[model samples]
Target: MIVRGVRGATTVKANQEKEILDATEGLMRTICEENEIDPENVAQVILTVTEDLTATFPAKALRRLAGWTHVPVMCAQEIPVPNGLEKCIRVMITLNTTKAQSEIHHVYLNEAVKLRPDLQLTKDS
Candidate 1:
């Protein structure tokens, strides 16, 4: 199996811990399901959030809520550009899989969806 990374991002209404964690967890689940991921095969996961998000780190929530204890996860701060996506949590999960790049799916959810209209899962949006 070759290792590939799944990219996903989601934005919350505010910097609250609960909202941030929930949105992040949802985005991760969606990406995992779409890519047929096996947690055991996951090499590592890196998460980033805009500087405005100070309530909590999405990576910590993933370990707690998703039971990714065996998987190595890290967190960082995203560049805080003016007028950037607020409370956004971004994830890059490197996992071992047989799928090719063409078959891999990336996700952008919530208001973050507006960041990449071309990549949205459906045209009906």
Candidate 2:
């Protein structure tokens, strides 16, 4: 088996706990779904939100939503660039997979796509 990193990001409507948790859950679910990941094969998940968002730990939301009680999940602040995506939440997950790196799918939803124009080849939601 090989290890690969999957990246996914999305924006929050506000810093409220409910909003943050909802956005985080949505992104995490999408990543798992798009990549066909099995929870047992997931090594760990590192989630970061823009410095402006701090209502709650994004990783906690991931754990709760995915029932990942035993997975190693961490939360941190993303580098605060002056003009960075506002209220953005991002995650990089290391997973055990038989697939190659080039086969992994990375998702950037909503306006977060602006962060990666080269991957904007798809119009599907």
Candidate 3:
């Protein structure tokens, strides 16, 4: 199997802990569902949040998901760029898969759709 990266991002209305955790969970689930990823196949998950979101570590959301407890997850601060999007949570999952890189669907939900307008996928997509 080859290693592929699934990318996803979502925006939170506020920096509250619940909002951050919920947004992170939603983004992670969509990425996994879109890519048909199994937790065992996931090598690592990296979650990053914009400077404005600090109420909690987004990685905590993953641990709450069934079968994700064993998955290695990390959380970090996103680069504080000038005029950058705020209250944003981004995730990149590295997983072993038989599919080609092009087959991997990158999810961009909520206000994060602006980050990758080409994706054209939202909460329902």
Candidate 4:
């Protein structure tokens, strides 16, 4: 099995801790479910948040999930670019999988759907 990176992003309603955590958790769960990923097979997860979100680290949310305590998770601040989406959280999960890159599902939820409309699983207004 080769190591592959699964990407996902979501927007939070606010910069509160709970909002960030909830959004991160939801996004991660969707990515795992859609890709059928095993937590044990996940090598590491890197989370990034937009400058507008500073209430908490996205990795903190993963700790609340089962079997994720042992996973290597890191959090960083996303570069603030002109007209970049706000209150956004992004994750890149490195995992061992036999599936090809094209077979992997990348999740984009809420207003983040605008970030990658092609990968959005649900219709967004």
Top-lDDT structure, candidate number: 4
lDDT (CA) per prediction: 0.82, 0.82, 0.87, 0.88
User: Which order, best to worst by TM-score?
Assistant: 3, 4, 2, 1
Worst 10 residues of 2 by lDDT: 116-125
Please state every model's RMSD to the true fold in angstroms.
2.2, 1.8, 1.4, 1.6
Residue clash pairs of candidate 2: none
Cα deviation of 115 in candidate 2 (Å)?
1.1
The residue-by-residue lDDT of candidate 3 on 1-125, one tens digit each, is 99888888999988799988888888888888888889999999999989888799999999889899898899999999999888888998999999997788999988888888776455533
State the TM-score for model 3. Answer: 0.94
C-alpha TM-score for every candidate: 0.90, 0.91, 0.94, 0.94
Report how far off residue 100 is in candidate 3 (Å).
1.1
lDDT of 2 by residue, 1-125 (tens): 98889888888778898988887888778878888888889899999989889898887786676558888998889999998999998889998999887778888877677777786332224
Output the TM-score of candidate 1: 0.90
Error of 1 at 111 (Å): 1.0
Model 4: per-residue Cα lDDT over 1-125, one tens digit each: 99999988889888899988988888888888999998999999999999999888889999999889999999998998999998999899999999998898888888888888766364232
Residue 12 CA displacement from its true place in model 4, Å = 0.7
In candidate 1, what residue range of length 10 has the lowest lDDT sum? 116-125
